[model samples]
Target chain A: MKKFLNDPVNFVDEMLEGIYAAHPMVTYVNDDLRCLVTAKPKAGKVGLTTGGGSGHLPTFLGFVGDGMLDGAAVGGVFQSPSAEQMYQVTKAVDQGVGVLYIYGNYSGDIINFDMAAELADLDGIAVKQVVGNDDVASSIVGEEHKRRGVAGIFFIYKAAGAAAAEGLSLDEVARIADKARMKTRTMGVALSSCVVPEIGHATFSIGEDEMEIGMGIHGEPGISRKKLGAADAVVDEMMERIFNETDYKSGDDVAVLINGLGGTPLEELYILFRRVRQLLDARGVNLKHVWIGEFATSMEMAGASISILHLDEELDRLMAAPANTPFFKHVTG
Target chain B: MKKFLNDPVNFVDEMLEGIYAAHPMVTYVNDDLRCLVTAKPKAGKVGLTTGGGSGHLPTFLGFVGDGMLDGAAVGGVFQSPSAEQMYQVTKAVDQGVGVLYIYGNYSGDIINFDMAAELADLDGIAVKQVVGNDDVASSIVGEEHKRRGVAGIFFIYKAAGAAAAEGLSLDEVARIADKARMKTRTMGVALSSCVVPEIGHATFSIGEDEMEIGMGIHGEPGISRKKLGAADAVVDEMMERIFNETDYKSGDDVAVLINGLGGTPLEELYILFRRVRQLLDARGVNLKHVWIGEFATSMEMAGASISILHLDEELDRLMAAPANTPFFKHVTG
Candidate 1:
């Protein structure tokens, strides 16, 4: 593939520089650290931060704004940002209000962010952390809490940001973030693998006519391998697993997210949503809201995920709260 | 190429349904009209709105949030949303603070948006419209005012939204938006054409060894065709034109945007930015900010665009103001 770069190693740094240049309202620490902080840190409002490997545009960084994250640390393509980098972002965005750190459930991310939280506490900056493990496909039937977090991270960010905006304490933010995670569940499938710039090749190879179910965002091994199927069938498989994993009964209100894994077109996402609508309706579940697009992505991988957040009246109110960020936004009803 | 839709024509409606399903805080009029309005219409602040076609996910809708756009009229893929749709969004979001109609310079968008403005006036709602004609590519010498707007529309949205969020009046917001457009310029190149869902094929064709300059977002013809060159050379060519078009003086402040046309990666964008930085530094221009991503895309077309906005103190202040949206957010410094 034709590409632009002098050295593969410099790709992430250069992109960060470009981002910092275009958005003066956004600041960064160690260029090598890949830690980005918002220009405005709301004093007295709990700070929320997230970081992960790069490549998913607008997920971590894009969520930093008036009612979203306070800072973000971006790692190299598909690699978790370093612990030190997360620590710096945590420090930068800290404004007397304690900080809440949320990120995906990847092993590296968990270790690094956990380390960063500890480091923040040492700085006299109170910090709490929440890991988003919402992927139903990555968990055993009985170990649902260990699932990998996918695009459903947006829900956590929204709920946490709104809580912070409402002057919730750090512990309160973390508590609500955990609640959001509990309400969220995700499942993804991949039809193709992405070519990492530094790696210079596909992370995993798949036959043209094959698809992998429960594929983790960072190209982690999925639960099942099968031939490519229609969009509805794919949606059914993902929704079934996600529904089975999450506890929801008829008449329950839920938020549905049909997220593209970077390469899938809106056309296909819609096709998948059609089936999702049918199945949810049939189950007597009230689909209160929906979002479809490339939210969290795995570079140029072609696939989709279905995420459902079973909502209570409180969760519904929080979800309806106005949110603004680079990659997602909403105004309450 | 593998795709997700059973039928091509169902792209927009299906996508809209998915959006509503996922985001409970947003609503649509005509439900099938593709115009998205925030559920909370009266935020006690002036409402900002934008409209465009589908290919640019997050551009129109992504900008809707706190300190950004209040609503968006999304059209068919790469097609202008109708005037009636724009009118509907305006009516929905007008909280008596008046409404600002911001859009690109396409003839269709202009005509339709104007119709919407007139329709709003008939309903006793104050409305002001500003067109983003920021592309330095499509105009002749001394005719930059006629340039077609490209990705620079985002800058206009940010600046104008900031002003409105600060309680600027309708006319004041319009002026700032116009000022932003005056300082912005964009130029795009296409490495490959995007396959339209309805067509199931590329709207245009280029050879494996070739690319085109000054291409429109919707696979329209470009100003020039040439063999694909190195990433630096390609950026240098784009910069040379954009630099000369802006007449940016030494030590002048400007915001630079290196945007992917949808399919390019960060590796390539950064590679191009590496050269962009060198060229600007050599010219003594102070780079105030940079946004590198698929902020404005044309489906999965593999190409990139460069946008430069000469910043004055006022424009800079507005640019630095906080903004929150789905695809982008600006925090005050």
Candidate 2:
């Protein structure tokens, strides 16, 4: 594995230490550095909390800033954080209003976050949850809750965070979060596998000339592994799955997010974005907002994921609203 | 190659087209999609234009937007753009206040940009150029003018772009760019080589357990090729070269930019940044600002470069000013 690390055991902790040293906008809430909360947390606003595995940068922790998550319980690479850690974050970030949890729809995350919600309820902290199930390739239609949440969780964050920032009640924020979760869909194609630091080797392997369509971030099996072909062909397959799986129809508006899975270059993401826009245009789906970069990523995995958020006026406005984070920032509302 | 491209020959143009379809803020000039200019160009302000080879995504063209470059003449991957292209960009963005040129220092770039400067001169437009030579590993201490430019050119961009946005004259903006260019220093390491899409093979090679310290973006030789070491060790070697080769004294305030060449993970970049901050703290250097990401890259090369900009009050303020680009965006000064 060509990774820069000290002790494999300290990979997650050291990465957290690095984040603490790099930005003044974030700080740990307790002795457990894994329990991170935003330093600029807004008072009297409903708290936004998100957490999951660690390899996906700017996803779980990096989004903790203005107009986003107020607290994030960081996990080890591809491993869920503990219920105790999540409870710590919820208690720390909650300021009488309540805390809303938004995280990916993975069994490990669901169990931990649900347990954390129970623990928080015992502490008089009102907790509501909105789980993301955006990766359509992970499950069949009508079984959307079984799908894995990928980069499309970012849309849920935007909707819910903006709602909380607007001083909405926990139910209102959860409503918007669920709306975003329902509207967004994602599909990924991995050209190469990523290594877990502790493992110090690739968790999975594939032929040098092959790519796996709809690969999970943790090297889980994708729908198909085939010889890599033209960019347009790959995007067409992805768009077909997303369109067939989601409720999007003609004349609908969308915010397209082309996420680079770690090792993919920005040039390639734009190349992928080009086809996505064309595909959307041909389908009479209006591309209203475009974000083309690495919002969510695996660790040094060569791939790109296409995430489309079907946008209504409220979601479009909230997502377009100014957001500031170490990784994602938009100045204009 | 597992690169997501249709025709390797159309790599640059397709990436440009993708950019055009994605963001309405940038549009090309004169049917040559290579000549990109900001759609939100500020009239009466000194126009900042930068250009060079493509593949380094945010490096050359992606910087063209509000508070950054007004125009950029793009080139094929790892190749300098033509003098005609630069001249076209200069002429189009010359808003009566004259234009300032800032780009990397290389024989190909200097030759082309200088020729373009002459062409602009004949057109009665004042053109001032700041060629960045900030790579500390490229030359001896006193012979800094012979060094190669890398990611440190971004400091020059932030300074000069802010100065121009402040309505400074071309000369004043160029002066600030020069100051930033002089104070900044960078050093890099390559874990693997990158492929130019059209070339269809790796431009250079290294062993699995090897890393080349101070390697140039286009596979230029570095100071050492030793066994791949820990992140701290790699950073120590890089920091030694930067400090030993520059005039940084104790108690200096500087901004740090740990830029992934292309393929390195954000986690590794942060791990490297942790050591960087520790070293700077030990040396009594105050780390005023921190930027850690892929600001410049070598298409999927596995490596990273560390750039430090020593700041005076004016440069500190200008560098900290809000600048918006498709790649680089800062909402706060």
Candidate 3:
């Protein structure tokens, strides 16, 4: 494999060490390398935390800073962090207020975070969670709760973090987070697969002229493989799936995120966004905000995902609130 | 070539249209799609403008915002913009305090920007220019002026933009920008070649087991092609060359930027940064700041570059000054 790495087994630890060295705002919790917390925690506010595998950057770690996440429990690439690591990060960021765990809806993450919350409860710390379930391709209708989370988790983090920063209680914060998750939807298409460092090979492969529609972040089997089509056609297919899955309609306010799957360049992401905007305008969807970049990604996977969040008044206010993080920063109302 | 694009000929215009649509802070100058300017300009300050080819996302267009470049003239993918585009951007951004043109040192860009300056002069708008030459592999020691510009252009942009935001005169801003350029040095290694959309093929090719050190952004030949080595060894060779070509001393304070060439993962970039920090620490160099991401990039090239800038007090202050752009946002100092 052509990669800049020392040893495959030590990639995660060394990467975390490098991140700690590069960002002053990020620090280890209780000397545990897997648990990264903000250097300065805001007191009397609900502590927001998230964690997942290492490949998707600007997801858990990059969101740890003022107005976003308080702590993050990072795992090895494509693996889950231990319950012990999550407990420690919870303890590190919790002030007088409680801690809430937010992460993608994966079996390993759900199990570990539930164990950590149980452990934290014994230590006299209140804990709650809202698992993200935004991927429409993972399940059929009436099975949205069983769907996997994808790039739409970013919207949940922003809205829930804004609510927490407003000094909401842990229960209220969890409610807002769940509401956001219920409204968000995402779908992705991949032209290539990503290689995990330890594996030293691509997780999967596809024909050069074919593309996988509705693929999950971890190379999960998608709807089908088909001959590669034009950008607009692919976008139209993805958008139709999303619209059918969600209750969004004309004259509704929404937020849009065009996320790149690591290997795609910004030029292509923007090109994809152009078609997305054109479709939304024709449908009379009022776009409140648009974000186009690599917000979450599989390591060096060539693909893109579209996420749309139907915003209510409360969700709109929370989404528009100020946020300052290493990867995301906005000073909108 | 596997890419998400429509007609390759219309890629640049579509990408720019998407960027304009995504960023509310940006708008076209006089309905000209080639010239992108900030919606809100700070008057009586030196108007900072930078432009280049379309592939580098955050370089020329993403930096047009508060406390950064006032405007950007965009070109086709991997192609220099025209003099007419630069002249229009110059006219649009020029307040009473004149305009400063900052871009990479390339033959087409130099000729076009020079022509734009002449055109602006006839229109009674003062224009001064500073070209960046920081790539250590493009030229020998005495021919530093002939070196190609690379990721180190970001440092020049930050320093010069901060100086211009401080209301410095045209000459003062140019001087600071030039000083920053002189103190900066960069070297890169490419694992794979980028594909130009119009050509629908790789710009160049290399053996799977080989890497080109000190390669130009557009696939210009590098210093050597050798079997790919460990991250530490590659970094050591790059650092040794940079140290030998410059006058950086043991007690120097510097800012380091580890920039990805579009396709490398952040995990690998951090792995590379870990080795870079170790080398600088052993040399007694104090790192004041570290930036690790895709600051400047070829379309989807698989590689990375390291840039180091030895800073004096003025340059340090300028580098730390607050700036808010679409891709970069820091509230330091």
Candidate 4:
């Protein structure tokens, strides 16, 4: 595997160190650097805490800041962090309005966050949660809850962060987050597998002329594997899959995020976005806002994902709110 | 080569089309979409225009916007735009205050831009220019002008963009850009080669376990090709080379950009950033500001570059000035 690292085992912590060193406003909530919390905490506002594995920059930890998530419990590359770490973050950011756990729908994260919620309950801190299951490729219609979360977590974070910043109650904030998760859909394709440092090899392999459509970020199986197609055909398939799984139709307004899975050039992303825009217009969908970049990544994997958020009144308003995260410095609605 | 594209020849144009569709604030200055200019131009403010090859996004076209650049002339992948296209941009952006052409240093770009400047002179638009040559490994200190411009152009862009925004004259804006370029130094390492779409193969290649230190953005040979080392050691050598090429002393303040080449993970960029931070701090170099991300790329090549901009007071203020570009949304000094 080709990559850069010191010790494979220290990959996660070193990355966190680099992040902590670069962002002056970021600090660990406790002795563990993985338990990251913003130095600026709004006491009266509903605090949001997310926990997930590393490898996805700006997904969980990168979103921890003003107008976004307040704290995050980070794990190793595609590995789960401990429940104690999540509880530490929950405790640190719980500024009396209670804490809301908004994270991916993964068993590791769910168990750890639920345990953290129990620990918070013992401390008389109310906790609510919204699990993101927006990857349409992972499950069929009416089985969205069984689907995995992907880059679409960005929408949920932005919407829920804005709701919490408005001083919403914990339940209201969680409701908003849950609603955002329900409205978002993502589909990805993998051209190359990302090399995890500790593993020192690709998590999986594909033929030179092959690609896996609807592949999960962590190399999970996809709905289809075939000869790599053109950018237009690939984007068409992705958007078609997303539309089939949703109630998106003519005259619907939506926001779009074209996420690069680490290795794709930004140029290709815009190319993908161009076709998506054309497809949406052809189908009478009104594309309102667009964010094109590496919002979520899979550690140098050569691929990309398209996330469509069917925006409603609340999501439209909240998406427009300003967020000052280290990663999405200009990701306003 | 594994990539997403319809036809190799249509790559650059399709990418530009995607950019045009995604950013409504952006438009072609002429019939040719390669000559792009911002819709919002500040009358009486010195206009800044740049042009270069296609693969390096944000390096040229992505930097065109308010507080960054007024216009940009794009070209085919790793190929220079025509002089006429650059002249189109220069004329469109020059709202009677003159135009400053800031771009990377390369034979093709230099020759074309010089031709464009001569044409602008004929039009009496008062054209000035600043050529970026900050890649320390491309040339020695005594012959710095022979170096290649890499990620360090971001500093020049930020500084000159701010200067132009402040209503500086063309000459004054060029001065600031030149000063920024002079104070900046950069070094890069490539773990893998980038594939040009039309070429349909790698521009160059290295061993699976070997890396070339100081590789140019377009796969120019570096000073050394050896087995890949740990992140810390590679970063240390890069920093050591940069320090050797400049007179960066203790107590001096600086800004940093840890740029990821196309295929390197953001995590690795941070790992590199962490070492740079420690190296500077230990040398009594006052690290005041930092911008870390894929500021520049080499078309999915696995590598990164570190740019160090020694900041003076004016440079510091200008770097902090607000820039609303499609890329670098939060990159204030």
Best by DockQ: 2
Off by over 4 Å in 3: none
lDDT of 4 by residue, B154-194 (tens): 99999999998888878889889999999999999999999
- Candidate 4, TM-score vs. the true structure? 0.98
User: How large is the C-alpha RMSD of every model relative to the true structure?
Assistant: 5.3, 1.0, 1.2, 1.2
**For residues B1-333, could you state the per-residue lDDT of candidate 3 as single tens digits?**
789989989998898889878887889876778799988888788998899998887777889887778999998887899999999999999997789899999999999999999999999999999899999999999998899999999998899989989989988998999999999999999998898998988999899878999999989999999999988899999989998987777889999999999998888899899988898888888889888899989988999999999999999898888888777776662
DockQ of each: 0.26, 0.85, 0.77, 0.76
Report lDDT (CA) for all predictions: 0.79, 0.90, 0.89, 0.89
- Candidate 1 vs candidate 4: which has greater DockQ? 4
List, residue by residue over A1-333, the lDDT tens digit for candidate 4: 677789999999999999999997779978999999988888798989888999988777998877789999999999878999999999999899899888898999999999999999999999998899988889988877899988999999999999999999988888889889989999999998988888898899899999999899899999999999999999999988988877878999899999999999998998899999999899998888789998888998889999999999899888888788889865442
Question: Could you give candidate 1's per-residue lDDT for residues B39-125 as a string of tens digits?
Answer: 755566777889988867666786787677889999888889988999999888898879988888888888899999999999998
Return the clash pairs for model 3, or none: none
TM-score of each: 0.77, 0.99, 0.98, 0.98
lDDT tens digits, residue span B81-180, model 2: 9999999999999998899999998899899999999999999999999999988888888998899999999898888888888899988999999999
After superposing candidate 2, which stretches have Cα over 4 Å from the reference?
Answer: none
Determine the TM-score of chain B of model 2. 0.98
Better of 1 and 3 by lDDT: 3
